[model samples]
Target: MADKKWMPRWFYQLASPRWCYEITGKLLPLFVIAAILLLVTGTVWALAFAPADYQQGNSFRIIYIHVPSSILAQSCYMLMAVAGAIGLIWKMKVADMVAKCCAPIGASIAVLSLATGAIWGKPTWGSWWVWDARLTSMLILFFLYLGIIALNSAIESERTAAQSTAVLALVGLVNIPIIKYSVDWWNTLHQPATFKLTERPAMPAEMWVPLLVMVIGFYCFFAVAMMLRLRNEIIQRERRSSWVRDLIAG
Candidate 1:
C-alpha cells in the first residue's frame, strides 16, 4: 500500500477530496496574488518598456498575451490528459475531478490563443486567417478540447463521463506535439519559437524577461482557475460526506 512511511504525507492527502479542497482553498489566495502582480507588471513592461519590433513595430506587443496563452493551453491539455490517466489507472476521485475541471479553462485559453494569433497575423501576414500548419494544428487542438467538454456533458453518469473524457483526452495527446513543432516540420508563415532553453533568447532581455513573467503569471492564473473549479467539483461530489456537510454548515 502507499501508506508506508516511505510515501510522502501529501501524496496520500492528494487522494482525499477534502484534503485537496482545504489545501487548494489555502493556496488559492497566494496564486491569485502572484497572478495579479506578475500580470500587471508584465503587461506594463511589455507595453511601455519593451522596445518595438523593428519589422513588426507595435503590432508585436500582442505576443505578450498570445505566447503565454498558447503555451498554457498546451500545458493545460497535457495536465488534463495525465490527470485523467491517473484517475483511470488508480481510481482516484480527486484526480477525476481535477481532469474534469481542466476542460473549460483550457478551452478558454485555447480560444484566446487562436484569437490572439489571428490578430497578430493580420499585421504580420496582412491576413486575419491562413492555412498555415501551425495555425491549423492549433485550431485542431482547440477542437479537441471542445470535444472533451462536449463528451463530458453528454454523458449522464459522472464516472462514465470522466472515463470517456479521459480516453478522449489521452487520444488527443497526439496533437500537442504537432501544435508545438508545426512551424519547424513544415514551411509556414508562422515564426519559430523565440525562446529556447538550450540557447540564449533571440530577443533582448527587456522583451524576453517580461514575456517570461507573463508566462509565469498565466500559469499562476491557470492554477487559481483550476483550483477554484476543482474545489467546487469536490464539494458537489462529496456532498454526502459528513466533512463536506460540516464545511457547508459551518
Candidate 2:
C-alpha cells in the first residue's frame, strides 16, 4: 500500500527477503555520497583548523577521531543488540541482516578507537596500553565484536546463525553501561568527559567544532557502511528467490 510504502511499514512488508534487498540497494549510493562529503570536510576541519591543546599541544587533535570512533563503537553495538532483539522476538529477516551488517563495522570502529587511543597514549601516558578500567573495557568490547562475527559464521544455516548471533549480540550489550560509567565510578587515569550538553563544551569552540563535525561524519559513515553491507547480505540470502533473479535479470 502507498501508506505502507511511505511510512516504516517496510519494517514488516520488506521482511520479504527480496523487497529488503531491492530497497537497501537503492539507499546505498546516496549514503556513500553523504559519507564521503562529510568525512572529508570533517577531517580537514579537525586536522587543519582546530587549535592546539594547552596541555597536549597538537597531540590532543587525536580526540576528534578517537572520541567519535569510540562513541560509535559502543553505540553501534547497542544498536546491533537492539536489532538482534527485534530479529529474535519478531523473527524478521531484515532485522537479522541489520545485526549482521553492524558487527564488522562496529568491530572496526572499536579497533580504530583502541589503536588511536594507544597512539595517543604512548605520547601522553608513556605506554601503548594500560590495564586501567576504561582501557580494559575497550579491549573486552573488541573481543565481543570478534565473538559476534565468529558466531554468525560458525553456524551453518542462515536462520540458525542469525538467531544464535542475535542472542550473543544481546548478551554483549550488558557491558555497554559498564564501559560507559567505569571512569566515573572509579579513580582512573583517563580524564572524565571534556564535553557535556548541560555544561558548555570543555574545549574552545574552535577546537570542539571540528570534533563535532567528525562525530557527525563518523555517524554518516557508519550508516553508509551498514547499508552497503545490509544490501549485500539481503542479496546473497535471497539469491535463489524469484524476485532476486528477476531483479538481477532486469
Candidate 3:
C-alpha cells in the first residue's frame, strides 16, 4: 500500500539526525535502567556468590572488577570509533554526539582497568607494573583513547571535531587487536585467560561465573553512561533548535 511503500527502511531513514536522535532518546532510559539493575545484581553475585579460587583464594575475587573493566576498556574504543565514522561519513549529528559521549566513558574504563590490574599484579605477579606486551598495549590503548577525546574537545567546530577524532580513532584501532593477541604471541609474564569452558580455564567455575557476571554488568554500565553523556551532547549541539526546548519543557 502507499503507507508501506512510503516508509523508508532503517538505514535510509536513519540518514536523518532527527530520526536517529529521537529513536535514541526513546531507548536511552531502557539502557540506563537495565544497566543499573544488571550492575547491582552482577556485583552482588560476583562478590558474594562466587567461591574462592584454588590458587589465588580470596584474592581471586579481584577478577570480577579487573577483567571486566579491561574488556570494557577495549570494546568502548571500538564503539567510539564506529560512532565517529558514522558521524563523519553520514553527517549524522547523533552519531557525532555518541562519539563525543564515549570519550570520557572509554577513558574511565581504561583507568579502572589499569588501576585494578596494578592492584591484582602486586599480589599475583609480584609487581605493581610491568613492561610486558599485554600491559604495554593496554597502556597504549589508554593513551589513544585520551588523544581522541582531547581532539574531539579541542576543536571549535563539532563537525571538524568528529572528522578529526574519526581519524585518530581509526589509527588507534590497531592497538585493540595487538592487546588481544599479545599474550599468545609474546609468551609474556601475564597469566593466560582465567576463564574458559570447553578446554577449562586455569580457574574454576566458582571464580569464573562472578567474573562473567561482572563483565556483563560492565557492558550495561558503559551503555548507560554513554547514553547519558550522548543525551547531554545532543542537547548542547541542538541547543538553538525547537526540539531540544520541547524535550526540556516536556
Candidate 4:
C-alpha cells in the first residue's frame, strides 16, 4: 500500500503502449493548435514587427528560424538520448519508440539550421560554407542524428536495433556541450550565444521577446511531431496486440 501510494498513477500507465497511443491521440489536436497559433504569431512578429539589427541589418531576421531550429535540434537529440537510455535500462518498448521517432525530427531540424545558417552566412561571412569549429560541430551533430537513424534502420531485430542506437546516442552526448560552447572555446566565425542563462539578453526586449516566442513555439511544434510519430510507432509495434486490433476494427 505504501509503495502503491508512493508511485504515481501516470508512471504506471506509461508502461502501457495502448494507453500512450490513446492519450497522445487525445493530446495531438491541442498540441497542433498551440503550435500553429504560436509559430504563426511569432514568425509574423519577428519578421515584420521586430526592429532591424544595427549591424547585420535585415539578414539578422533569419535568426528567428535558425536559432530556434538549432536550439530544438540539440534539445531533441538530448531527449532522444535520454529516452534511449530509459528504454535500454527498463526495456520499455514505448521509450524505444519515442527514441526512434525523435531521430528523424532532430535531423530535419538540424538540416534547417544548417540551411538557414548558410543563408544568413552568405551575407555575413562572405562564404556559404566555412570550416569554423561551431559549423563543423553542428554538422557533426547532424550526422550523428542521421547515423542513429541509419543504424536503427539497418538492424533487423527491433530490440537489438534499439539497444545499438541507445549506445550510439549515449556516446553522442559528449558532442552537445562542445556544440554549445564552441564559440567561446575556440575562435570561430559563428558569434557567441545571443541568449545566455548567466547574462541578460544581448538584444533589446522587442527582438528577444519574439525570439522567445518562436523558441517556445518550436518546442511545441516538436512535441506535436514527436507525439504523432510516437502514436504511429506504437501502432506499428503493437499491431499484434488485442488492443491495437480492436482499435483498428473499431
Task: Please tell me which predicted candidate would have the highest TM-score against the true structure.
Answer: 1
Tens digits of lDDT, candidate 4, 114-226: 99999999999999999999889999999999999999999999999999999999999999999999999998889999889999998999999999999999999999999
The worst-scoring run of ten residues by lDDT in candidate 2 lies at: 1-10
In order of listing, the candidates' clash counts read: 0, 0, 0, 0
lDDT, candidate 1, 32-128, per-residue tens? 9999999999999999999999899999999999999999999999999999998898788988898999999999999999999999999789999
Q: Count clashing pairs, candidate 3.
A: 0
lDDT of 2 by residue, 132-168 (tens): 8888898899999999899888988888988888888
lDDT of 3 by residue, 1-21 (tens): 124466558855665555766
lDDT of each: 0.93, 0.85, 0.79, 0.93
Candidate 3 has a TM-score of 0.88
RMSD of each: 1.6, 3.2, 3.9, 2.1
Q: List candidate 3 stretches off by more than 4 Å.
A: 1-8, 12-17, 195-202
lDDT winner between candidates 3 and 4: 4
Error of model 3, residue 40, in angstroms: 2.3
Question: Predictions ranked by lDDT, top down?
Answer: 4, 1, 2, 3
Candidate 4 has which clashing residue pairs, if any?
Answer: none
